[model samples]
Target chain A: MTATLLEPTADPVAAVRRARRGPRRRYLAVLGGLIVLATAAFAVNVLLGDYTYTVPDFFRILFGEQLPVATYLLMESKLPRAVLGILVGLCFGIGGAVFQTTLRNPLASPDVVGVTWGASTAAVVAVITFGLRGTAVSLAAIGGAVAVALLIRSVGGNVGSHRIVLVGVAMTAALASFIEYLLSRASIWDVQVALQWLAGSLHASDWPTVRAVALSAAILLPLLAVLSRSLRVTQLGDDLATGLGARRFAPDGMLLIAVLLVAVAVAASGPIAFVAFMAGPTARALNGGRPTLLGAGLVGVVLVLSADFVGHYLIGDITVPVGVLTGACGAPFMLWLLARGTSSRSSS
Target chain B: MSVSTSARLVAADVTIGYGERVVVEALDLAVPDGAVTVIVGANACGKSTLLRGMARLLRPQSGAVLLDGVAVHTRSTRDVARTLGLLPQQPITPEGITVVDLVGRGRHPHQGLLGRWTSADERAVTDALVVTGTLDLADRAVDELSGGQRQRVWIAMALAQDTDLLLLDEPTTYLDVAHQVEMLDLLADLNRNRGTTIVMVLHELNLAARYADHLVAMKAGRVVAEGAPHTVVTEEIVRDVFGLDNRVITDPVSGTPLVLPAGRHHRPSLLAGKSPTPEYEGAEYL
Candidate 1:
């Protein structure tokens, strides 16, 4: 009988427990460590600014003790900025990983494929041409992302990841030209505002912006979590995934969720560059490449918060926004990754 | 951990293809339960397509593949997955995935919605590694492995599924001679010891003849000759199916058929090196 043929393993059933528990425990520990680091960075961003509000000041401000300059600076502006940064990072990190893992291409993230540029072009058009302001701009951005994503899908011809990247590259180029053309046509004051938004800043952080991102997260994160298990299996080649009972529709569904996440993220933070692209591979390395969405998200939070803090405080005189800093840091990293050419090498 | 079901699979009146190009048409075949069935054919001959259809990786345009008298496509895929496992040719191994983790993915069908990796999943993975002699490589990354080791690791993953029926497509394409034998031997052990019904597409005629309990030789999208390998593998069938002249000899060791293509040379004797035709010797020399 097959039962008799199953050799008695040298280690008792205990080996199985270790095999399952060991890497997961280590991954969770690393994720917890990253979270703690992000939280510490966030606290410093809130409390260690020029005015230097302490823990007591934060607590008192929370209790409605309006301590003039400290309350306005710390509780009102910095607090919302830091919270919004974390949510935006989570969206980028998880969304990027979802796209990369499902498509099985490291360069398939929304950033690489012009999804962010699509949103920016739409938002810029709304501001300059339509003369739109407030929530309409955000809606325009989301709509842009979805529309561009659909365009990429159509133009890329369902061939593979490389095709999507090529189409995305073309889209990014075309949109950049259009954005520049729009910028040249705008008034001086509008140009400054558009420039700042294009660079991706958290300068005008208020509860409403924070609340919008939070509400979106509240709805989307749980939906993503429910689908995450199926996402893991879909990472295997499609034939094997379907062979294991994953629905034939799983990849398309995951792609939709990824697009939605990207759209929400762009609407909130104006397409923070490379957070989505880098988060997946970074988290993959941190956990020894098993593909953990949570790990990617935590890394995203850390990257964004640290970049923001550095942008605000590290430089003197002129304040550089977080996206500029991330772009400055990320461009070199992307070049190095490109030079390494390992992304194309990770084949199925 | 317990799956007790009939490993009976049948493809009835099946017509399958990719878009407009038809691969196999009007084919009816039943897999012998608890036995090894090898489908052999020349290039682009639809052997792999048939295997894929039977494994439910492809749907027939006209007919259905039935498992235990119920249509496989109509049945719950989760249930079918638990009943059957497949190791695709050259499966993709994600970058930097550990051997143990890769094999544990086989437990996907057994997993719940949350996919809590159970102790049983672990045991199955470990048992599979041990069976395939890759237990020592459990911690190594798959990309770092040699091709043969990677193939064995993939087999371990399939074995971890612990299905009653397993289908493999060209499972030995990448292995060297010794390793190919070793891999076939391992499959044979699984068939003998566990009674797992295996359906595979193999290109090597000699190995197919030696190992298959049921050998199906295909030509132009139809089974040309099929039976026990000893009966089906012959000069006439080889010439008909493969468009080649061949002599079948008994493998001295296994007592199964061995195919040697009849070509420009044969065993030499005292007076044997001339062309057999009269037109080539007397008239042409004159």
Candidate 2:
């Protein structure tokens, strides 16, 4: 009976649907795998810290039976950092995917396009120069991101991806020098804080940071989801999008949402280096080269959590920042991608 | 391809441009209902700009484009999208999107935020795939298809829009000769069977003459000729539009006008009792 139903002549529509379902199912399954991997990584992140909690002890902390030392570590450092890692990962991943899709270039993520550094430069300078901390720094960073985006748009003149990337790279260089100059001029104590913040460390993360990011996510994620449909239409290029009845500035809202997410993530953590740059590409690979926001975000969660875990436990006594590890991993991959891109362009 | 009954898209005194430079100026043209209207011109003669204006891709710098006697620019774009479909010159295919899903995106105007992906959308996509003969390629990646197949897939996407009017801009840019003919034939079939009011910018004069019921000619952002294919595809009009001395002949197969450019070198070969293929003693490139 099932075989009869499966026959093409009996239901050609069903046959077409069934044939189409295979790749989509594979994409979903890859996304599911990334989710599972991220959840497992998140668990490992909470379980293995300075005072290592066994699986059973971890459950006890989760279930509200809090022993003194274990509970203190769990509540103060471990839980907040793990949660913040996942949150930051989601933001960077989704943000990167949005930028890449909007600009139609793999290298157009927030980090590569200088939006992440825009936030970082503002936050770092705010801490060093203005003596601002916490929410004020975050707000400044958000403003900086918007300002940088506007500046890039103004300078780049709404050109192709390659030209915009060149402008972004120049912007990033200018801002990086500004940051370095700020670090050089700061007093020794201010310099340490600025350096940590510039490296995009989760070391300063506490319950408040996690809560703040979570609250922002609660408001922003839904908004991004709502706007993502228009983003999808905009991905088919301006002419086609306009033809499809999308408003002329439809992608503007989505880009702003993505920048806001990046700002919030960068505020909670530091710039968190290549998590934004790497997430979209990794997710596309896993999803069979389809640039999905969810998949990219999931990939980012895995990358950040796993990088944090590896940095803390696997690398021994010296505690490296998540941003450092991501930078180390991302540099070679970015170079390889650039090389492959040039070869492909030449061939085409 | 819904039957176009009352859907009339026309540009009245419309001018279009990128920024300061005007591409099309004061173009007063009416797309005849339920027929294939092909706009032909030399490169950068504003055929594309005219199509863009008619499709509402470009807001006219002056005057207005009318859809069913309503100003197209003033109407809600989502509402207009339901009645008219456009396939641009070079559309982007998002990486790794399957043929079916890509075509299914055409149902965008029909969807609400929460009520997206309905059974109606499924039926529209399926019918589009069937009509374009892309059902077998439904599971295939759009980026991986051949040039001709990709063109069909794009047409299928436009068909899934289920609009009474469809506009296309240079739909046969990179296609080879046979595929170009096949593409034209498929569009002709859609025009004949569905009564879709099709308007397109085409570079090929012979193909345009053969397929277009209504042929419009443009030169330097202005219309030089507008009427039936025979009236529009004459030698004088060709010279006027393209600035080329050309001989226009009746197509052996379709009885439509075929343009043969009378260049300095080719004229001697035409006069001599010899094959037009230039003789070369050297070996062909391997």
Candidate 3:
């Protein structure tokens, strides 16, 4: 028995080293595959269209070569929408992963945590109540999201898996009702504008919206990546995390940044339902239960771009809003999640 | 790494509790350096509360917990964490976290914001896993492990902290009898080999008597008796602290006092006719 125990001691570090090596290789391979797939899909979306631009022609237009009106369609319209779709997807994915992991609850997404609701409520209020437009709406949306986050954190009492989710759900319901009341009292034209926002769309994507999303992503995504390791520790619960020398404030601060990222995404293209909710869990399921922020972001990009493409082209002249499609898809998904949660609780 | 042998912990009239109710009063206690001190008491007896107070996880309401004559709360959290490690009961492990990753977190005190994983961190993690005999399971997810294996993983996480002072709260909660003895033996080895100061709250009076170098018995948020196990464990103290009818006997292996309760079967034949002994051993065991 002593000799057998001694054998394990000799090769103790080898197992951990090998385990670390395997995960790194697997993570890299998954990331590479997703990048290739996203790039191909992006190329296809850019090149193949109703305006009849070939792949080579699309490339030529991208390289600043003069071509037909089809080239203009490729350069001006589809490119910006596709780019915005990917950027918005990335923000949704990373933001969702951060919120879910930090709260230690699968149901804790930006939508469920009141960040999306906060942004939407602000945008709706801006358009209907204040008659605000353009950049002012976005600024109001950001302020609204930050205020809601701080308020919920302050008044939500204790921090726990169940308490955060319950408080977030309550806040979301309250905000949604407030927005509805504002819509009920608005003038017809203002109500129409608010209604369009309520059904989130990338219909208004131009150089400016794309620029806003790019700028937001550039600032937020790298900051999130830098804080990822600390966030991982935080998921282990506060006492253990603190015992391990993780600061109490850093993880909470990173979560606020994540909320800001989601708010920006919502500001760019209204609160697209379930993209933020579905991305993280979908990525985790695909990656075999390891929480992959980057991979989830990639998945979010794929989800939003594909949904937007289908919504745009599948129904021809109708021009259905992408948010409508997502809500249509997401409502059932949320119900299914609720059903699963109830069943799991009963069984457990 | 070897710790200084004479590292003493002094609590000068320390009072600790939550908001209004003071659990531990203005009581002075000294834990000798490089000794295994086991705290035993009933539930809500402030054994775990005192351990938390000493670890600076709880602030004292009145006095101070001092390490080497310095107030523990005055030091930075990182400084305190580096020297004093605590294993809390019922800590939640993040889903799908591997043992190596969890153990690696124990090195956080030694690492800075700019510092990535170093050779020292790697060595500490590896050493911890090895010492706890959990190296083979390092790649396994924590949730997938057995109860005994999971407890060892938690101990490995604490060991990876590389602190000279370790405090544990009910470390053998869910373990079987065999595993409980094994854990206490491992802790005893750690204390003896490294000269590490170990303070633990144990519910089992017999186990505490068998394992501890120094034993503290508490009742209703007060220290009733404290000394070497042989000197502290007595029938009168056991009856008063736990309110159980138990006889004190010498443990053959450890040569320490062991409390064997006189249940229904063990009651004398003469007393059986006059008044029947309680059939169930009381709620104290439960």
Candidate 4:
């Protein structure tokens, strides 16, 4: 290595490119593997129920040829459920990663930082108190998330990233109580629907839910693509980022996009717990510990779809909500991460 | 050098501060083109703040920092970035980032939003690594490098920006004496060979005097003295700027002014019979 460095390469450009190729190939390989896994998980979620269908059968139904008993079930329930899973997963994954990167903290995922809670609180209030349904609940969720984001920003006072995160945690606590109060007053029939908001479920997945999430993805993905270039600069901290000619408002733009993504995902999937929190860190770990938003989004699809499938088919007789399964696992992992972070910091 | 005739960066009565606490008040400086200028001051004397104002990191309240007769703040950030580069006092090193990737980010201003990693970008990055003598460590993670090496890698990153003008804040802050001299020497080489206009905030007065073609001494947010090291490093200005009672003598190695502080206890009389007559034995303090 020393000899190579001492004797300058004939073409420095080629040498640099050769040096970079290893990591680039590894990153691309990880992304490709994730895409394949997500597709398989989507297929499993859609096709591998009590009544199984082959790939050709699924594709045939997709092209509008009806099978005997499979057509109705696949079209109405399984297909929409799988599609909504992919959409929400993509949204939460990208949103959570963006939030984490922007705040420069692993603990700053949307679900952990009160964004999902905001959506849930508004959604519960809309369902129980206002007797709202369908699209109304989604709108309330989006409004609630945006309102909470603004509140956190105002209360945090622009001092530090941790201040905003602390304010968000406090808001999450306060909003949790408000949600509980609304739930206590809800009628039994209303509570059944409100439970979807409290503990997230894909059981309520329908064509409308899928369409609403798809619409959001259509708007947000383009914005994310444009804004992601700034992420590379912003990760270097404000002083250097500004010196490197990054737009002053780039971080704010990223945060806004992340908020909208989380809000829309929660509106569709009822704030499926920890999908937003888990996906980014997982994808980053897979990418050799460098953050990748696209990888995170793809991982989110796999996580939610696989978890939903496990809850429905892999478990025994009783079906579990996807939220409960994720929350069961995610809460402990978050504690572990926090503990590790504190210990490492103190030791260092 | 004629300051008015050849100055590329001129701070015209810039009063800059954070919030209402004004740190630098009505400070004017013309950084001579194609020369190394070092700003030296005691703590909270606004040398770093002055550099920030010139680098466009802070806005002057009433006056302007002009580059090529145009206000820097009024120009697009990319346009200013192409002409100038700044290495902040403490720049963050991203986790697990290689030296090459970190240096390559310096090409940001030259690239469009959707710009590909062109061969020119590759060459610039490679050139930066070579210039900083860090090509061997190009594939290494930044955090794993030693303090001196990490700092050189950061300089390489700044160099990759390929700006004619470079500003550094406390570039030798945490390094040992040997590394500090090494860092300043590398910068001097850049100025001499590439004619890159260099301005920096340096804590070590001796090193500053050695490396700076133009030396500035500041006190209480204003310029106390600025000229060649021989002219600027008089005992009177040292006392004025740093509140140190010191004797200025010629540096034996570099032939620049060197300050030797004299406390109430350590007097010049102690060295009377120990060494030959000092260079400034009978010279006036000024």
Candidate 5:
């Protein structure tokens, strides 16, 4: 009786392959489309800024042939800014997706979990009280994010993922108050400098800042790729992940890498609001609700570039900071997610 | 009874716990290879904890869980996973993951970082789905499947791991009576056809008694009795393990020991005047 039940009726290998093809194709198509979209957004950000330049002239400037007005504007500002945007976006996207996946909560992005607030508070303190500039401020931001991450872990102390998020929220609130207190004590000129920390701005982008972000991505992304196989296993929760032979510390290791990615990106640019928070969900939505780390990273690039463009050009008069635009856009989406009640669909 | 020296998995004086709570204390048992072993006890008797300890989900604090004569915890997890598979109770289903993709993930220990999906991997996954009768639901998202279908799909995932030993924790918890029997039958088939060593925690006593080749009854983190179901599942053991007033009788259909709880309100009119342990001819009726 059991033999008859165990017998295979036909070739199921073909059925399994056929089942996989549709989703595989859809994933590829979504991934390819994101790459194309990111490229276009980068182009639009660089070539169509306030002082617009033609494609040939932009390339000529890139190739080191100086056209008087185009040279300083393109080389000094637009190129570095756009490049920095893409790099920061990649870091935030990949890092945030890892956080959300591992913690099994969409709201567990680094920004929402106090990493951004930590960076901003430290950056503001460096600029205002310490009179720090450029690389020193960036260092402060990186240190701040890492410090907050450590604080969260120590304070939460094996309380599990949901408790960690609650602890982080409390930390973010505390750090945010510290920032406000510091701002209240600052002079007008200091306030202008500190505004970048309060709301993320790409206005400070230079070759050095671009290099810092690039170098971080260069070292970190490959490491992340090496560690990502366990990421897939870890998403099934700890017990099952262990059952499936995932390394004992793999989730913690991935989270640490994610924290560093967000830190470096925040160090290069001020904590760009919601890029980390929004990218993963967007990528998942685009890929027929499947998680795609690469797709999320590309989506992050597109999001930052487009947000930067809109913040820089689309708004009238004063240039709104990239973080401010993202905040405004992200708040609505967050509310939508809340209204949708994600308990039924959330994946760990 | 002597646990044979050839037993592949053994827990010798193992203690398991979480934080300050000691759940299973200094327990010893050897799992018979290629047989279905069902563990049944009241809630919090530490039966599940013992199962977790054996599966290496919880590390033993005092002694070691041995697999193939070596400390299981000392072995590389991937190597252990290739030999033993586990289906955790309430395993998470990633949002929008298809049945095939979820099942394919059971192949994790088999593949390296750069390993591509080979025909062998495909065969394993297909065989799993086919054996579990989930091939028709291969393309459907896991969240969309019914409770029974989802349970089968999870079993398929474990089956896809292609391990010789499988451990399940309460695999039939949420299923109706029919699905529970269906699940047990499927596991029995795996044991018979694939010669897989099966160990599971079950809440239903009569079902466990009917299906298990070996039955273990635990009370307060200690194994009170273990042997062939008929020998181990007497009315005295049931009262001792579960603290329930019950009668043990032969199942009319399966010729296995069947437990009939003697609740206050359910006494039959015909049996009201009879001796409590009245003998029956060949079998007992419900």
Candidate 6:
């Protein structure tokens, strides 16, 4: 017997629109609130310290009305560090999120992808082998990161997430060993300088480093925002994304740009640990399940600023590196993740 | 909503295969518009490959697949997607993705860079969900659904594309017999109600005969027979195509041709062996 089922009547567009709107608004509100809180924390961090200044005194120092020697410390020394911490944190956090989501793997951070390794290796080589000084090492680091990225992509075949990660890890390991070998043969003074740099300390911050990072951020962040939709489609696998009319090359280009941004940040401030790994997932978890680029950037800002504050002021006589603090926190989390992955695989 | 658009798909002398090993060669076929066409063949006979080529998933080595007199490969992918949708066999679903979100992705071609989650896209997604009887499960994660439910959700995703031409590769795969019948009936209903042109590769001959308005039987990458089920299916044709001893009988309900094979286990009784049985009558021997 032949019978026809009548087409059902419903408003699909309204349903999907409703679905997307609720999450978008909630994420935006949460991000906005976090931004305000981070700014307040930063203010508190700047004003209250060993040589304390009132809020009014801090504003006076900020505008160029000089007060005492303590005012200069608050304005020049601590303020710049706080600002730089926020900026670099933003770069690492958002950059890490884009990398992980695009790859569809949570472990695919810029550090895991050899960007950090490339930058650190180049910086170390420039200092010890080539006798380079000042910001020259930063430039060398960027070049190294780009070269490693291109090399990994070439060797990994198709630009899928898994292949990229595998190639990146292999290249990073090789380069890291070479860096260690160089360090072993260097003089005591050279080794001390290299070790301190590798520990990722923001010991000396000036207007120049800030300007360079700001310039790079200004160029890269807008590019990432424009290509965000394409990245979302790319996360749905290649065949489906291509069928949906997105060019396969667009996501790859965006990913390369993200790598460049993170590389620049690492070159400026050394490979600060865990900021890249924690920023994206922390933001996403706080803002619900949607991919949160801007939110991650804000969370990165909070992470770096708080770590810098604690590093400088928490221990009385001893100064801990911001990277050290991040490592101290992040290493345990990594071990937990590894344990989870192993257990899941075993059960399966 | 009542838009009557018909596009004929033609494959001319198509040769398709992976590298170094040719599967189908110099094949010519025309898929009729606004009709349910079933392609039937044994395993590895290139039925799925032909469907893939027609959907432009695979590039033809020697020929072209044309849509309404124009080469399909020449048009932009989005333009082609607007008119056609292809549901591949056993696609993987991303983790924690709800049925509504998955189905909403089918409207990607219709959405512009700035035009996401529009009212029209939502309408198409809802319509697809309702048509496939998946509206109630729209909020549930796709991975959590049953096999039949998951299959219907995928069909909903394709339907949400709102294309006039639909191609399916073994849509009833990994389902129970009841679910297979239910899926075929759903496809037939869609063809009748929306005038959506459909072509599918099916392994079940009886189901294809019952549902398809036209059947194209392929053997060794060539069309061995093409006609209505009653005209094409016969005892000799079955033996030639499938290499089996079988008898063709009319289905009691649909009056369609049905094949019943004579297996080694089915033995003739002593009384039946002694008598001259009629053409349609057979002795029950177990």
Best by lDDT: 5
The sequence of per-residue lDDT tens digits that candidate 4 reaches over residues A126-235 is 99999999888989999999999888877876523689889889999999999888888889999988888878788888998788789888998888888788777677
Q: Cα RMSDs of all predictions?
A: 4.1, 4.6, 3.5, 4.5, 4.5, 5.5
- Scored against the true structure, residue A106 in model 4 reaches a CA lDDT of 86
| Candidate with maximal DockQ | 5
- lDDT of every model, 2 decimals: 0.81, 0.84, 0.80, 0.86, 0.87, 0.78
lDDT of 1 by residue, B64-132 (tens): 999989999999888899988988875777776777888888888899877887878877887787778
Rank all candidate structures by their lDDT, best first, as comma-separated numbers: 5, 4, 2, 1, 3, 6
TM-score of candidate 1 relative to the true fold: 0.92
True contacts kept of 4: 0.39
- Cα lDDT tens digits, model 2, A1-348, are 011111234455895678668877988899889989999999889987667888888778888997988988897889999999999999999998888877778788889889988988888888899998778988888888888987886787652357777788899999999998998899998887677667877788898889988998889888888778876567677777877877666577777888888999988888888888888888887777677899989988999999988887789789888899998988897987688666533100
The alpha-carbon lDDT assigned to residue A231 of candidate 2 equals 60
User: TM-score for each prediction?
Assistant: 0.92, 0.92, 0.92, 0.94, 0.94, 0.85
Per-prediction fnat values?
0.45, 0.49, 0.34, 0.39, 0.64, 0.17
| CAPRI-style quality class for the chain A–B interface of candidate 2 | acceptable
What is the C-alpha interface RMSD of model 2? 6.9
TM-score of chain B of each: 0.91, 0.91, 0.91, 0.92, 0.92, 0.90
Report clash pairs, candidate 3.
none
Docking class of 6: acceptable
lDDT of 6 by residue, A1-348 (tens): 123243432654555556555556777798888899789768867776677888787778788887768767876787877777877888888888888777766677888778778888888888899888788888988888788877877886665548888988898799889988999999888887677557666677667888898899999988888777675555566655655656657767777887888887887777778788888767765764456788888887888778777887897778888888987878776776567556532100
Query: In candidate 5, what fraction of native interface contacts survive?
Result: 0.64
How close is candidate 3 at the interface, in terms of C-alpha RMSD after superposing the true interface residues?
Answer: 4.3
DockQ for every prediction shown: 0.40, 0.42, 0.41, 0.36, 0.49, 0.24
Name the 10 consecutive residues with the lowest summed lDDT in model 2 chain B. Answer: B277-286
In order of DockQ, best first, we have 5, 2, 3, 1, 4, 6
What TM-score did chain B of candidate 2 earn? 0.91
